[model samples]
Target chain A: MALLDYFLRSKEKQVTTASKAKERLQIIVAHERNQRNKQPDYLPQLTEDLLAVLRKYIPVTENSLSVNVDKKDGDLNVLELNIELQEENSGK
Target chain B: MALLDYFLRSKEKQVTTASKAKERLQIIVAHERNQRNKQPDYLPQLTEDLLAVLRKYIPVTENSLSVNVDKKDGDLNVLELNIELQEENSGK
Candidate 1:
């Protein structure tokens, strides 16, 4: 019974340590995602900002444009910007 | 000159093929992200749906909760859900 109790306690400690490590990793990944999406040097944020400025004169809605940054090669990254214009609604 | 032209054309073709492959990979990754966030079997989506149903009875806004899934080990995945409550404003 004493041996079984020691084994169970060790297992609990291992599980706790694993959970802590996973939480740390999740925080790091979330930070990286935020930085990649919002940093000034990041291509996605730069393209979005540029589009926002251009839209002021172009008469385009914010939801009509979608911009994405994707990895091309192992290290190379590419940006793709797509804009869709809405059809004019006919009214009486 | 012909050999150089052939080499340049082949390089262009290789670049085109690589770009196509990258686009396919991007589509796959995006689909995986959507599936992982929305699929019924996925724990994150299940938890979110549960919370949404619960919030219908309670007072909660759409932006008050954040749910995420993370890989625990080589194969295991874990779900995390966090909810933040806003303080009431003091009106004059």
Candidate 2:
């Protein structure tokens, strides 16, 4: 809501980038936050399987999901996922 | 770009949220990508120091900068930071 918000603006008018990225990133963040105990190893397979399950109800695009592990934390392993879920209208 | 883009839209008119979030997240992503080998532990301190140094020339808000490590990736510690830089006009 202020002029200073656009310090990173670069003329790209993709309005939904932030919201979508936020949605995806939040999922990843939450997932990472929750799985700090088990240290899930089959993330790639897990994401692929989850994507398949999600596609049954909503259309999802390729590369719209990102799953990774970040070990910057000393003892905690973060399981992160960023997914773009298609609108229900786009589904059926 | 299309109608499906707003699947997560909830009538929040903050058009710059996604753009700004993306900008900040991209910086974090890039930072994490670069430091995969060293497994930096002083990221929060580093980001704080970086913010302090940046404040000399730019106006950055508290909580506008986020520094964290995501351990979702095995063997790679991702250093993540999201910073909102105030516009030059607002800075001066």
Candidate 3:
């Protein structure tokens, strides 16, 4: 009975450790994402490339456009390009 | 010289394996995200909850709103709520 009790306690301890590790990983990932948002080296070059492509279709200035790489769950990177279209630019 | 060459080859093999593992992980994650997008169980309930909260302030129907959980890189889940406000709802 004591051996069984010891095994059960050991299993419970392992589960706790696994969950704690997951929580710690989540915190670290979130912190890293925040830091990346603050200053990503590739953003400007990427934005410039995107803007050049977009200019062929739409008349957009640098001020009217914004771009960022958003980190998602499950190791997905989303490149979000936001363009504010002026009234004149629309309905064409 | 033979031993040093063997060590260098092993190191190169390890690097290749690590990069291959990363590529495989990326493909699996992309597939999982595609599958999740097709049928996510929580989206409707979350949308309903958001609509309920929004209705307290703005007069909106179910047709004018949308909600989805967008998975980002680095284990981030972004809940995007998009509401298409009519002309009457605007400039208030």
> What are the TM-scores, per candidate, against the unseen true structure?
0.26, 0.26, 0.24
* Model 2 CA deviation exceeding 4 Å by range: A1-92, B1-26, B29-40, B85-92
lDDT of 2 by residue, B14-85 (tens): 323433232121123211222223333443454455445445433456656655555533322344444543
Chain A TM-score for predicted structure 3: 0.37
Docking class of 2: incorrect
- Whole-model Cα lDDT per candidate? 0.33, 0.34, 0.33
Where does candidate 3 stray beyond 4 Å? Answer: A1-44, A72-76, A89-92, B1-92
Query: Candidate 2 residues A38-75, lDDT tens each?
Result: 43344345445544544543345665665555543332
Find the candidate with the highest lDDT and give its number: 2
- Report the candidate with higher TM-score, 1 versus 3: 1
lDDT of 3 by residue, A1-92 (tens): 22223323433454345322111000000101222223333433534553454454344656655544544442223344444433333358
Candidate 3 lDDT by residue in tens digits, B13-85: 5434532221110000010122222333343353455345445433455765544444434222334443443
CAPRI tier for the interface of model 3: incorrect
Residue B53, model 2, lDDT:
42
| lDDT by residue (tens digit), candidate 1, B1-92 | 22223323433454455322211101000001211223233434434444544353233456655555544332234343333433334384
Q: Candidate 3: how many backbone clashes?
A: 8
Q: Write the per-residue lDDT of candidate 1 for residues A31-55, one digit (tens) a residue.
A: 0121122323343443445455435
